[model samples]
Target: MCVQLQAKDLLEQPIWRTAELIKQSKRHVAAPDGYVSSFIDFIELHGGEIVTAASSCRVTSGFTDWRHLGQMGVDFGWGNPVTVLPLSTRRLLGSDEPCFFLPHSSVGEGKGDGGFKVLVLLSEAAMPGFKIEIDKFCSQEFGQL
Candidate 1:
């Protein structure tokens, strides 16, 4: 169910947006716009150097079903994931290792000051470690550090 967004001059042009629909056995509702906005804004504010306009929502099966993205957390238990959706290009910037946003998962609302910033994925080889870290974080203690 993964999609790739080819970049167009530093922006992911052919983007794929997922719908927000989830049931964690607690809440059965679609994710709010605030959550999505907060995420996109956070990246821009932090110098994402957005070469293209900001975007949210997804187009799937001839329908824009952004609501299904909620399963990224509610069903997958990754929390409010602000996935680093690769928008196309692998630039020779940022981390020196081809700066790009790869899809990732987390708990709680992302970047809205409701969830902790976790994981930095840039390659396929890193996924196993990422998941391990996620599990460790979830099992670890949390509170005022």
Candidate 2:
């Protein structure tokens, strides 16, 4: 489900509140009676508005949480995956940049590092700044990069 937040709402509300609102909205959408019956119905009702809104946006980012997907345990005739990576393309959401929250590699049955991994895709021009910020964050969090 896609939840769109207005800039004004984001700026006006605290981040935790915004996140709760999004979670509530997602739950509402996921309810059995919350959705349209068909794609045609959805398009007829909201397609034009969606297109216009998308056109007005200069930048868009997408995020997906795959931590619950158990991707690391998927074995392809070898062993559990050492790492899970997302494709750089964002055709799924039409985002310019995308971030994926992935599960940590499995060490054994019901065992893992108890941490997650984030895979981010960004423009080449943004990489340096992103790296610097990430380094800063790492140093602050763990006392080293």
lDDT of 1 by residue, 1-145 (tens): 1222333422533222212112221132224544355556777787645422313422111111233344345434644545534343333222212323223344344543433222233456666886786687777786331
Off by over 4 Å in 1: 1-89, 92-119, 143-145
- lDDT (CA) for every model shown? 0.37, 0.71
Best model number under lDDT: 2
Candidate 1 vs. true structure, TM-score = 0.24
Error of 2 at 8 (Å): 7.8
Worst 10 residues of 2 by lDDT: 48-57
Error of 1 at 79 (Å): 26
lDDT (10s digit) by residue, model 2, range 1-145 = 5556776888898999978887886786677676434445768888764332254567667778889887776889998887777754544455777678888756555467578878788889899999998888887857653
Clashing pairs in 2: none
